[model samples]
Target: MPYTLIKSSNPEDFVLVHRFLMQAIQRLRAAGIPLWEPEDVSVDALVKAYGTHSLYLVMDNEKTIGGVFVLEEDALFWPEIVTNDSFFFHKLVIGDDFITKGIGHRVLDALVELAKSHGKHWLRCDCHGDRPRLRNFYESFGFYFIDRKTVEGFDAARYEYPCL
Candidate 1:
């Protein structure tokens, strides 16, 4: 389905984003995706995400299918990995029923487009390094896996997508 890319302006938007993430986690469990196991994504954390970063909501006409938070270079939580001044994708996923429904890709592609239009040469994101499926997902879209780095026991993958 076609989706509209929207920037969420406040913590209230995270209430909707959190619901989508909860659904995504459920779907990942049902699908047996191991690294998708996130025990508690508290509203406080979600609210923090909204306050510190740029939240992009993926909507298909009338529904909020998914969302991802992007923080520009120099924002907090950005480890100095690849030094090209790139955008970052944090908390990226879709609702449970929305998974396998092609919504996540739509939002990501939109972010890539946004980056390229702004003359950004790279788009970077990190995730659980144990998730090879997610690695493949990012790779298929041209995001190259740079390395496996750990922060607080969560193995993280540093992915870089070069602009075309």
Candidate 2:
């Protein structure tokens, strides 16, 4: 299925994004994945992210299915790298009803194309280090594992996909 990414700017969109993120957080927690805390997805946090990140609502036709945050630079997770040739993806959340339906793959493919259009040489992202399924998902999507590191008190597994 073709998905559209809408850059969220208004307060209403932010509320929707926050709810989507919270649902994702709840799902992860239920699966014993301590990926995100409630505060992490709060409306205020999402609003603050607008200043430094681009928040996008993932849509399948007219239906909103998920959200993602794109950043030009991710100093918190990739402090060792100092280049601007990368687009960092964060908070990628697909609705429970949309999981296991190849939506994740489509989303990543879309992100790759978006990065290429922006002249980004790499697409970088991080997941909880303990989540093997997520790591494998990224690897299967052509992202290579970089390393595991502690960022903001969480062990993160970093991966990067060359936008070639």
Candidate 3:
């Protein structure tokens, strides 16, 4: 199946984007992954809080199978204050059907490219430290573990990859 990556530019699409995110959270919970936000995170709130640029979706035939949120700093999962020069990410979910098909890597590359287009130097994210699969996955993308500790009382580690 073919796929397309689209930015959240229209309100109607973001509604689906919100549903996409809720389902992803549910899926991760089923897989025993630690998710910070409650699955009840409202679509209207997400759309209102994130505005336009922070949301993204990966679609195949208009069906959203994956989605992510990019933030400058202070994502819901990552509440600690990070210093300048890095674009941050949180709440990334790829469906079971989308797994290992290079969708995650594609989105990472796309985000890095998008950041580079804005002259950003780094792309940063936080993840559960003990999850070897998740940790190794980001490492393959050249994101190094910068701070391997619980931040803001959340058991997570910070990872960063140079974009420039």
lDDT of each residue in 1-164, candidate 2, tens digit only: 76878777666766777787888888878988776778977878766754534887788898888888898888889887798899998888887777766779999988998899899999999999988898999999899999999887989999999996
lDDT of 2: 0.84
RMSD for all candidates, in order, please. 2.8, 1.6, 3.5
Which residue pairs of candidate 1 clash? Answer: 23-96
Candidate 3: segments with Cα more than 4 A from true spot: 1-5, 37-40, 44-53, 59-63, 75-84
State in Å the error of residue 53, model 1. Answer: 4.7
Cα lDDT for residue 106, candidate 1? 66
Measured against the true structure, the TM-scores of the candidates, in listed sequence, are 0.82, 0.92, 0.75
Q: In lDDT terms, which candidate is top?
A: 2
Q: Candidates 1 and 2: which is better by TM-score?
A: 2
Q: Number of the top candidate by TM-score?
A: 2
Clashes of 3: 0
